[model samples]
Target: MKNVMISLAVMGAFGLSMPAMATGLVAIPAAGFTGTAYTLCNTTGNFGSSTPTQPTTGANNTCATFPANEATSPVSGYTLIASTNRNAVIGGITVGAVSDRVWRNTAQTSCIFGARFTASNIDWDTATTGTQYFEVNDIARGGFGSASVNAGYYIQATNASPVYRIGRTFTSVQHRAYKYDTAANKLLLGTNYLDLPTANSVNTALTGEVTGIGPTVVASTTSATQDAIVNSNWIDFTIDVAYVDDDGGSNIVSAMTYVEAACDSSAVSGWVKTGAIRLRQTGQENTTLQEISIDGYAPPGSTVP
Candidate 1:
């Protein structure tokens, strides 16, 4: 339940254009970055060229695109690997639409989980409200299957869930690890409750959570709250595979980087549109070019890389 601090570095960028052949959960390297910042992009398509395209500020670049309606497969570029039954009812609440995808660096060293969604209004849970099942959000290893829950580790926020009894508005983000049963097809109780910001940044109370720094940008000190996820917004969280493993979990890192995984935002109920769930390799933990740790586990003096 401690606050993790890391200096904010400029968001890195890539220049490679989307390729037609590159598709699915294939790992591709986002050019090795020299600065402490990790390379990032808003790619919705395939990867091409020797250097992966870097992201720039104010550019809502398109790596993948969907039509006016929900898309089973991306119109162009890579396809989503996860199943369709994404937003299952948890804690007696039904998450409207939670579409997800995964991307990785070719090195398969670092891993990131990103969930995108569109909503006109965002909801928040307060301590006074007791518990509202739909207020929480989640990032899990498997898609919310039709018949059963996926067997793996999942990170769920407390919101107002009785599990942690969290009541704060912004601080409601709980970083607890829960396991699912393959045999039973259900989610087990959570353990290892670590306090985490709803969004990973110097200040979780600002738009910086949604508006990321771009490749050319040198540095950033801006801040914003966990605002609404509208207009196909994407929020990414760095996954510490080793940290989870040390805490009695296994294969989570491998499943995320090499195998299959899914992340979704239940922050908004009755979501208008669902976006791609993506994963990207950030290299191993404690690296000079790693993204900010979502669980506040940044190495001493580590800034966003």
Candidate 2:
């Protein structure tokens, strides 16, 4: 009986489609449930090392108390307050309602300075039947998904343990933002976001058969950098693979197997590039060839700044 042989190869292709999702203007609260306000006074010494004293000696030094209703519920999304002076103003959310609790300096006027609210210490009442939602502002600071609701990006959180939701399906690239631990020091992406049900399924879908080789062969490349420009903080990756198979001998040999090239920014880490080319034997040493190239881009904002 003639030996029937099968050879399979798999490559990691970085290229994937990311369609723009609708986003909306909304306020997310800061990480800490509460915030404190401080007042700055004048000093006559060297401006660099000199410290300012409180406007008042001891008791009266503290400015007017912050408003009561000012401990804004998740309702008031983005609120702005005027400066009482270059210094004195409400210090906390206690005495009365103030428009904006957070303040910005004249230099930062063009910038929206708001708290990136997070529900760390506060217990998230997910069990409540009502609209169990929290609000945050200055979302551009730190948050997953886009600010626009229509943009399809939204914040999601999970406890330290796994929680299952039934009747929901997700694509391979969909992600959810969640707290990984009690400290809330870091935000994490769950593998569940990848939504891969079984490892074998991915293996089968990407596997290709080996066929032939070409006279022209090329080696892989590598690139690295520590400092990068803002919008340009992305790494492009490409990989090429070459292999051959022999049917009569029921054997296969890899001609070249390596990463083509990789680029990275100061943000994300542990990125690699890879590709594959397969050849199958038609007769003795004759073969058929198929080539596939894989590429991906890693942007800076994706990781810690």
Number of the top TM-score candidate:
1
Model 1 is weakest, by summed lDDT over 10 consecutive residues, at: 1-10
TM-score of each: 0.24, 0.15
- Would you list the C-alpha lDDT of every candidate in the order shown? 0.22, 0.16
Candidate 1, residues 166-191, lDDT tens digits: the string is: 11111212222232222121122123
Tell me the tens digit of each residue's lDDT in model 2 across 1-305: 00100100010022221221111111111110011000111111111011112122232111111122323221122223221111101122111111112222233211121221122222123354432112110011111111111000111111100101000001011112122122221123222322112221221111111222221211111111111111111111111111111111111111011110111223222221121111111111112221112211112222311
lDDT of 1: 0.22
RMSD of each: 20.8, 29.1
**Candidate 2 RMSD to the real structure:** 29.1
TM-score for candidate 2, please give it: 0.15
